[model samples]
Target: MTIAVVWLEDDGLWCVSDTRISRRGQGGGVQIVTDAGAKIYPLNVECRLLTVERELYYGRRYGMVFAGMTAVATQTFATLSGMCQALQGASRQDIPSLRDVATLLSKLVELYVRDFRASTTLADPGVIEILLFGMCPVSRSYEIWRVSDQIVEGSLHVAIDQQPARTGDVVAIGSQVSRFQEILAELKQKTENTFRLPKIAVGQMADASRGDVGGAVSIGICNQFGFQTYWSLGLTPHGQGARLMFGVDLDDIGWVGPVVISGGGMA
Candidate 1:
């Protein structure tokens, strides 16, 4: 399991996630084996689709952060990425709404669960919960949605719930939710907590969770200026590449030239 946190600050939207991906061993034990996994996908120029003329076209400038079952999460991300590419090539007004995105994801999870149930005779399909965060271009705000699938009435039932972040609000998902709440409460009690960073709180929770949640913390910020990586593991190469190709440093503070939101009228 992993941890993902999303919040709205004065400047923009902040997202943080741990890179630890665990698995069950042959002896029926869980193992924390890697720290190189990415939990945040910056939906900017890096993920753009190329046209037949070999020209690059921009998609939505946002970040998608997730935490849940690895198999399902990865598959969902792949499907979403494909959909984003398709949307980019479609009509300019075809941009998907936040609810549309959530619904599509929920349907994907339901279909996966249905296929699993059909293949296995087991009564329980187990529990799967995926938390998704992204910026809604139509609403111009950061939204968090939870997609949960479980065995209900001996069949798969999926539900998608959405919450829009307000200024100073904190939202968290995955194994470290409770821990994040405790830290948030403590921070609220302090009189001088205005300058605290969300990444620091998430990093502290990951560190305290031992191996349950760990690895280098990855962060992304999205707002009117567009989405950009605040910090991430092994980001130097990516930063250099962006600078070379886009003429903007991905690591630079307040850098807005790296990504362009097409048809949304925000350049």
Candidate 2:
């Protein structure tokens, strides 16, 4: 299980998620496999995605996180990270926009799900929820997007939704959903717009969370400068030789471990 939160702020996007990956037992219990899995990914100029829309509009500088089948999400994200790295040296004027990047991701997910379902006996590819937040160069506004896929009624379901937040919005998705409402309400009451509340709240929850969620958090931000990922809350480790995220090295950017969250909204 995972505890992922994306708090879209007026200036940028603050995000966090637990890094523990687990397997469920038939008896309705959870087992931890590892606590060092990378979740939040920071993308920058090291990657440039080329598109016909490049000349039309520069896309979003965004950060992404996912929950669900690790293999599916990891594999897909690996592809994306590579695209980012390859285009890292490309001219910014020709990069794609949030809409184009999102569309490409949706198509990739659908293709992966279909291939998996056909090649394996598994009914589906399992649930996958990917959260992308950042600034759209065109609108010059912050945005949050979700690309998700799963099997329902023996059919595949893929959805891409645009959910840009304003002050007082706290978006939470993962193993514990109902458990977050009260916390969100209390935080909102304390502060109308601030990242501190959400960050502290998520830390407390993760510390006290059941087997459904565990491990240190990975945090990051996406704004005018692009994605900046942290191995932990406000901490970015350096000099880690060629650390890989989902099987791709982010241009030797110092990275290992999970991410953090400090979600809040502002006008």
After superposing candidate 2 on the true structure, give the runs of residues whose Cα lies further than 4 Å from its correct spot: 44-61, 84-93, 119-126, 188-195, 231-267
In candidate 1, position 80 carries an lDDT of 66
lDDT of 1 by residue, 1-267 (tens): 677877878667777777777865668656876655677775532223345553344455666776656666677778766765555434345456666777877888777667765775645345456655566766766777778776767656898888657777777777667877777677767756655456667767655646568655666667766676644323233333221111122345344578632211101
Clashes of 1: 0
Error of 1 at 124 (Å): 7.6
Question: On residues 187-218, what C-alpha lDDT tens digit does candidate 2 reach at each position?
Answer: 77887675556666666666564786765566
Please list the C-alpha lDDT of all candidates, in the order they appear: 0.62, 0.65
Which candidate achieves the best lDDT against the true structure?
Answer: 2
lDDT of 1 at 77: 70
Show model 1 residue runs off by greater than 4 Å: 25-29, 44-58, 88-91, 116-127, 232-267
My TM-score estimates for the predictions, one after another, are 0.72, 0.73
